[model samples]
Target: MLRLFSVLIAAGLFLACLTGYVLENYTVQQRTYGGAGEHLRGAQPPYPAGGMDNIFWFLQVSDIHISRFVDPQRAPDFQKFCTETIDVIKPEIVLVTGDLTDAKERNRIGSRQYEIEWQTYQTILKKSKVLEKTKWIDIKGNHDTFNIPSLESVNNYYSSAIAHLCGHLHTLGGFMPVLHSRHERGTLELELADWMDNRRYRVLVFDHDLFSFVDLKFDKWPVVVITNPKSALYSSPAHEPLGKIKHSTHIRVLAFSPAQVTSVLIKIDGVTMGSAVHIKGPLHTLPWRAKDYSTGMHYIEVRAQDKAGRTTIIGHKFTMEEVRLLPFDIMASFILRSSHYMTLRVIFILVLLANILVIIAFRYLTRPQLKESPGFFALVNFSFHVFSKTNILYYPVLLFTCYIAVGPWFIGEIVDGHFGACFVFGVVVDGHFLEGSLTFLIGILQLTFFNIPLICYLCWCLLLRCRGAYFRSHIKYTGWSCSVPMHISMLGLLGWQVYACYLLQKTYGTAAFFLSPVRTWSVILALVLVYKAWNLNNSAIRTFKADMKNCPYS
Candidate 1:
């Protein structure tokens, strides 16, 4: 009945996994929409006839990392930008990508959500009054997700946004704009430089259906965003409709500078299209026939130079048709985005399968036997002769096996300020189970390689003794041969524990010593076990001939 039950459960799990795999593959192929660079030829354009007239601008900031405990000045600096720079730009919207607060403790080893940091972030927004001036959108970064059980948890202090924006990498010196492909089907991914150090932000302008942006430093001038001929790199008709550039009559540019604007020049395909005339504040226009270059993709360059000799040149590919990401880019994006969940899934499946295999092997080994078998069984019977109940080594071996099965292998702060115990079952963080922990993986390994084998060896010995098998005459000759493998497995497990301790010390600092006392003890235990196993294996081989001399056949 037990075997049938195990077989049924295994079959069900396999079928469920196969079904999910098939469905997932089918869904992915259908969602790809004919793979990379394929466009819907007859799709309606995003912008109407007068694309330049429908323009709006927004401000984007990322990786604020506001930490009152670490960098107290960052909060005030961000506030200053909100008040001074934001007032000048007067953007229609403000998008904060992520990393609103630094979740690190003073030691920088542990992580937890600090209410004070979140309150500081909130106070800055309210004090700046920037929230009232524009639509503010903020999302959680990887830092925000640390130690958070879920998004709905009270510990999660992030303001909700339409989409999630990542700011964990602090990539490109936080000065350049990047589009991550992992965002949901119509979502746009924009990563901004950190407000903690660089004081960088982006001014993104959308004119008609064309999107143009400029990365700006705090108080820096000559902010330029091309208002016409949208960059082809950002073209996504599935998400946002694009304008038909064939109907455009003039090139439009928005350039802002504290000093006098000297020249705003336009270029198409590297050829000069003449200087643009300043029509209004930050608005420059140059007449061009968009129909001439409408058939193929063309490069548009806008150079804005001020009286202060500050030259800012921006270039982008513009085309009338839609553009799609390459297949490799799409696959990479999917892998990166799903990496966390994928790891959890893979580990869970591997552990599950390992346990199932252990159960099957245990059942097969302990099956009822009419007569003693040869090879491995003969070795087991011979080894059990030394492991009889009366032997002095038997009690020590049994006691050690039981201790390892139930003992607390290590104790540490599983999450900031929360001390917990690790057992064979799993790691208990505070009072709750720490899901998807690597410590738990180690426990499973110990059970498979060390505890189970030792327990089986002890049980086999008792079984032979119950059958009235006599081994006292050969006890002095046959040493603990089976015990060697058991000790070696324990040594390996202890070695793994030591490596884990080293990693903890490297990552967390001196605090690891105080937090995990078992790490130090494990090293001592491993050395002792290695010495005992070596002595026992050597004694067993030396006594083998003596045991054969006492046999009835000899």
Candidate 2:
């Protein structure tokens, strides 16, 4: 009855979580830039046409990773970037796309946000006066999310923004730009490289209703953005009306250079049109008939050369027709974003189902029989009787396993100056509870992988010391049948332990294997159990041989 109840509970939880995932991901549509009401109402009015008055420029800097413990110079360098580079560019807005601080400790394994790092970041902004010069927008990266219980928490020092920009992977490397499906819905997802090692930042220009951007290195000159007849690859009807692009008169460009304004050359289909004239601050305009190339797709290349002998070329594919992203691109982005959540859900469901099956199978195998047979039934009965006899050592080991399953197995500085528990249910940081599927999975793993094997080993040892003749006869009849499953379970548990140790070593260095009490104790207990099981196995084998010799059937 208890086993049946456990199976039902597992099934219930699985269904509940499955329903929750479906409702959260599918039924409830995520709000876009146009807001939830707009989405529910379907396509609303298209955005206004592009114009010179709508032109503006901004700076996007990501992965600042200011660290006071590891590299002390990081904070100073960031401050210098803000004061020297930001002041000169004088962008209307500065978008900081996360990783405002390196949350790791000196060892780099422990993840906890330090207040000093946040204070240093604030001090830099104030000292540089960048906040007063431009609209500073900052969002939390994965690093910033670490140890953060809630957005309202005092430990969360990030300045909230409308869109979330992450910088956990440092850089996509060769992947460069990974545009998302959200772009189709008028939300641009741009990821910038790290500023810690690579002094990279993006200069994004909003020309009319079009968006054009270019990634620039520190001190790199002639930041160019082609503004007119926007890139067809990025143009979206949700943000801008595609029908109005054909009425554009001149090909406009925004070029920012450290040196004196130089010549801006415009090329269409590899043919140079003419030199663009400087209209205003960083704005260059070249007259071009939009209808001339309105029939098919065309490429626009803008090459800007400064007096400092530095040249930069940027190209974009433009078309007067409607822009549609490839179907594969949209699918790929959706998959990449939701892959982790999907994987966790699948694994959680599988674990629950497997446990239910195992319980049902065990109950069926151990059920009372009207006529007992000397095959698998006798083996099951023999195993059950042996395990039913509990020993004094079992109590302590069972208590230890329970504690490990539920109690604080791993405790560290989860929040600034707040040491919290990282147990089976979840992590508790500064009195806030953060529970997830991963935490529950770990608890299930502890119960199945660690507790079950240890309990079985305890029962096996007790069985070897049993002095009843009937029990000895049953053991002889069962032979290796009962022992094989226990041995297999123990071997599987040991394998899991070794794999876990390797994972810990890989992630947090070799010191973590020994430093983590849960892992260290698990290894020690497994080794001890293996040694005891071996000795008991040999004793059982001797006793079986002796009983067989004395039996009349032999």
Candidate 3:
């Protein structure tokens, strides 16, 4: 128990340190969401003083997660921009958007976040020179005002502070109303002014999901006009009827790859009421470190208000697309033109070579002699040597490994880490379960070389039992010959893993499969393994019968 506690403490400290390093080292860049169309000087409205109508540049930044995972650079960039904008432009009013902290903000008191985010906010305020100066205010962004303290609660909590800062609260408070007004019955429900108009121009803060919606403003209470480009978030049928939508049946996108042009179909129980839109370009890929990213909900209901003041709701779903990726040479020559295909190919070759080297090493080093001993014991010993001698000091090392390295890696955070290794694991596991025989030939060389050996070793260890004594005997042939039941159990596990991987590949596409074909092929190869197992089981039974014959039919 003491050893276990020590390990837990050590792991916690390691993770905390890692997270801290990321937060401290990185730099932030100034990013803007609103006030893109026009620019104006600060603390000065587009119009003169004492005018009931006013216009000023405003920025809305939500989900501003300031945590270990958040790029540290973003925080400082925000501070610099705020400082420069405050010192130079000095707008009449400023609204600091919500979601200031990246930490797990279940509680504001004991959670270490108060000091971090509070200080960060204080810096922004000091640098902006707005805290003691202009009409600066804030409202709840998703991160800050979400479930933890509730948007309403946080708004109320910060109300006094914001009121002391500036009069911009009146403008931001109506931002959500402007955003929702486009929806059916989305008329500006706020009993407040929705637009800022002077002799020069008009500015509006619309607060709907920007990707799928339009932006507009005019000199009317409920009557407004949209004059921006089409929003990326909405899903329109490929076959639009004229310029208008005739029958807006719901469409669902099962899968979509913006670059690669791939997608799958989805089946909603009833009529599909929404179409999923996934668009990936150069920007989202850079900072997010995404090869091919995807995010969509199972359900999104559509609704709108008519000219007669009645509201109608509709449902929709549509086909999904898989962003396509190919060798850059192929694309450049035959498709879009050169964009670093050769570089990727070179890297790919290097990785393949590395996997081959590792596989050759593992098969020779770990393969045990074929005798009456367990195979899993050999694997355990091998892993112990590779990872460290820590396992020798404590048995919990194995459990901890499975939990940390395997369990969490498998169940959570599928999007992070060395993706190629994971892809190979998926390929081999999937092939054995679902595809069938001969799929082994399709296994990526890397998966076969690297991942298969690991699967074989893990299976062997899991089946042979947790105790070291269960596998005492070793031989020059099999290395460690596990008993018949143990061997069968290991084989079965490998088969299941293969099946699960194959399914993931089929459903998600072969981004990972191509990365590690060997593992993918092993999964396909699992089918052939069943016959091998049956033959071995029969051999074991036959050998037992022969021994019994000499023992006198008892």
Candidate 4:
């Protein structure tokens, strides 16, 4: 029974090592700009239980252009939108892409005008009480910054208000802060709405100035209109392609302005699908369906107008596909796009190897009388125990580590306004592709310098278990088989993980990286391991002393 137990330990460790390696490699190789890249083309799942049939709706509003130069009625206009118009639509979430405020004038740098504009923006939201009803996220635009020439006229505007934009965002609720590395840039993730199954969609948002106005439409308050049919990427004047949808697929559209916007109109191939039902809510989706239309290239267009008679129009050609209800495909699309076909085969082989190791360790091998005769298998058996059951916190620590390794993807889901699905993992490891891979490099450095060394040190402790007699004559060794050094090493790893969490917090402008449910538990797990190790080591020392008193040699 003792031998069988040892074999099981060995098998478990071997399996864990293999699993860890496979997951790490898959995550690294599949990292993409937004996530899963082009694999998102057809990964939409079915709607949730309460999802609207044949229609998915979301609101898009952009370029409020809140400026100090605007008339006094501007504040009231924003208020009416949030309290009256937006409250009526009641969308699932609202996307305020960029240009929340206009700061093109260089003279406004030190005039306190910039502060007032932001104050109005905040006050409007507060008075409207819309944030609680809907998820509203705003990014940065060129006009929101100081003296951005390309978007504005190229003039020598002596302004020092470059950093003020982020300050306003920090004060406003729902917007993510600007991230700084060598330069300040704004970033957010947008997950495409999925159909009923597990289709994953994510888009990365950057806060920076554009080189030309040609990209403004898509870059502004962007809207993705998913059509049922798949067709060539048609160049729309303003909007970009969201994804491919089936006949019954749900689509979300964000309206740029609620106050200036009188009503949002949706159409399929020149026929009105539905006028988005407006309500007294912060966010609402205009649900529409396409049952009468046959499968072919169909045009999906949305237009929103304000009280001033200004209108924004965007349309795209969509190819409708035959609907087939299947299981989740977003994750499967990622796996298929990752091109790691060997994962299943490798897992199978690893399982078989583990079983063989168990049989050999328990059914055949025994602790040999001679030290050298026991050889590498004995060392492996001992090493397995080092990872499997050295400290009382072994399982807890291991589990915690695994959770953080994959927690970022789920967090991404929250940012993208989706729940009950995790399309990707390893947020820190994958990093933002546009950010010059800074976060990615940090992840690699942590693994190489911290995790690898910690594992090596733990494995080295197996040597201590080889046999006291083998080293007894060399230096008059003591029979103290305690895990003091191993305990210290684990403590070091725990300390380093805490530091890593801080690094992420500094970069992201929020402690959310470490404070996440997965990472918070990691800290507690490490603390428990530290305490347990100290107690076990003390007990081992006491037991060793008692054995010495009864020794024949004594």
Highest TM-score: give the candidate number: 2
lDDT of each: 0.61, 0.64, 0.32, 0.41
- The lowest-lDDT stretch of 10 consecutive residues in candidate 3 is 282-291
Model 1 scores worst on lDDT over the 10 consecutive residues at 30-39
User: On residues 55-131, what C-alpha lDDT tens digit does candidate 2 reach at each position?
Assistant: 77889888888887776677888898788778667799888888888888676756777888889999999999998
Which ranking of candidates, highest lDDT first?
Answer: 2, 1, 4, 3
* Candidate 1 backbone collisions, by pair: 46-241, 46-242, 174-193
lDDT of 1 by residue, 306-334 (tens): 99998888888776643432222443344
Evaluate model 3: give its lDDT. 0.32
Per-residue lDDT for 293-412 in model 3, tens only? 122223333333323343333333321222111111111122112223443444444444544444344434633232334354544544333322222212332232222222212221
Which runs in model 1 stand beyond 4 Å of their true positions? 1-52, 69-73, 112-123, 139-164, 172-179, 182-188, 209-220, 321-339, 343-537, 540-554
In model 2, the number of clashes is 0
Give each prediction's root-mean-square deviation over alpha carbons. Answer: 10.1, 9.1, 25.2, 19.5
TM-score ranking of the models = 2, 1, 4, 3
Judged by lDDT relative to the true structure, which candidate is superior, 3 or 4?
4
Top lDDT model:
2
How many clashing pairs does model 4 include?
Answer: 43
